[model samples]
Target: MATTPAPATKPLHLVYTVTNIQHKVRMLDGTKVSYSSWVKLFQLHAKGYKVMSHTDGTQSPAKTDTEYEAWAEIDAIVLQWIYGTLSDDLLVRVLVTESTAYEAWSRIKAIFLNNKGSRVAALEHEFNNLTLKSMSSLEAYCQKLKELGSQLNDVDCPVNDQQLVLQLVRGLPAEYDIITSYINQILPTWETACSMLELEHHR
Candidate 1:
């Protein structure tokens, strides 16, 4: 039979696109107000907090309404650009906390550049950053498990001694125990992220 050449495979791709949708609120008012006035209005509408500007309107005075609007527009543009690329839950969660959101944004940029664009890069970045110390401990234990397994494999033992290998594996519960512990550790962080995102439970 004649053989046909197969087409080349492409790397998995995921693209996030920002949509021009309704409900896009302007972060600032169109009125040309002083910095203090602008900030006061913004807080009143968005956060229900009353804010007062203490600056003397010099040396980096509060943002002008236009300047403030421009920055807000930039934020919307950036966020819109990244919107659909993230799971809705993740988006919502990060939006809840400025710290978490900024951390996520920084990590996302680093990961996209570092990995040449992969959603896995984003996930790995979040995972590694969020679970550093625990992950280090888990990795060390996993390495030990692999070393012990290798030692057992290299020994000159009869096939019947497979039971001995099983015994050795069974006796060392550290690896399995650690895996469960790691999972437990991850669950809470994930839950926190999800909660911040405002995703409701299925149950």
Candidate 2:
């Protein structure tokens, strides 16, 4: 029988609070963390106001006083969240005298989003250079690979199944050659490959 593996440690969660509204999720450091944080942050604010895809009236009808008021409230909350979550250094550098939540959000996005290309390059470099050392635990190796793949996906540069499977096999030590050969023949999905590797580790 295959023994169940212990679960991995979870990352710290990031929380946002203002007035009656409270939101929390795993920590976000702009670049290292998953881009899902970006989506989640927006969604949290979207609950109170329309933040995503908001127009500036040049293309559509101008907002009414009531609409503007509601927007302003949500923007303030979102701004608070951004200010609260960012590191002291980043907060100091990115902070601007913007009056609206949209402006603040756009400024932060401009700072981070513009670096996607460089971030993608760095991730790919790490992926290519990754290798399972003889002393390393298989679980740790697998976790690292999955993390890099996930971060890449978050930034709009997804690693396909075949590439992930291939990379894993290629990076294994020589002792894993026989199993790697078998894996190549089967061409299993990434999750299945991970399970098989874990099972092999147990054996």
Candidate 3:
């Protein structure tokens, strides 16, 4: 009986085209903008291979022929995707060179993730200094405050509801004395405080 040979597997590069990536994950630029989204996209694309640990060449046992081959293919694909997304300057600066995908991933994460503390501190400083000018629209001011608060929360330094409300009330100009007094008395949530301020602004 003649048995049919198994079909050859397609090359990983052809299987996953760079163009097919709806949102390409770029190298980490200084700005953290779109970083979370990029990380999510890369994780989704590199599922099953993204978190694999890199061998140290001494501590780890030698990989079997099949295992080595599989790792090589996946490593090439992952590196290609990562390199493709990087800016030319960044690619030149942080070139992964002979490092495995895991090493590259770790290095990139360390570069960006290490500055989280400074980021949180900067956001807190911004929140402290933010003020609602007399001429500023109440709605716009509130939106800016909320946006800053959201950014703080993203970095795991979220301002509590009570503190946020207090901050908002305190940041108001002297012209909003009556509304501020009313809000402070009740110690309302930030949303309620914003609403009250909005009403006062409209009046």
TM agreement with the true structure for every prediction: 0.21, 0.67, 0.53
- Per candidate, the number of residue pairs that clash is 3, 0, 0
Candidates ranked, most accurate by lDDT first: 2, 3, 1
lDDT of 1 by residue, 98-124 (tens): 332234445433422344345334433
**Model 2 — TM-score against the truth?**
0.67
* Best-performing candidate as measured by lDDT: 2
lDDT by residue (1-203, candidate 2, tens digit) is: 99999999754222223343334533456544554565575566555454443312222224665556545555566667666666666678668876565565566666656789998899899988898883268887777887788778866888888889999999998878888999999999999998988888788
Q: What would the per-residue lDDT of candidate 3 be over residues 40-112, giving only the tens digit for each residue?
A: 6677656534323332222222476556766676566666666666666556755755976566656666654
List candidate 2 segments past 4 Å from native.
Answer: 1-24, 30-32, 44-67, 84-93, 97-99, 115-117, 134-136
Clash count, candidate 1: 3
State which candidate, 2 or 3, has the greater lDDT: 2
- The whole-model lDDT of each prediction reads 0.33, 0.68, 0.66
Judged by TM-score relative to the true structure, which candidate is superior, 1 or 2?
2
**Model 1 segments more than 4 A misplaced:** 1-62, 97-104, 107-203
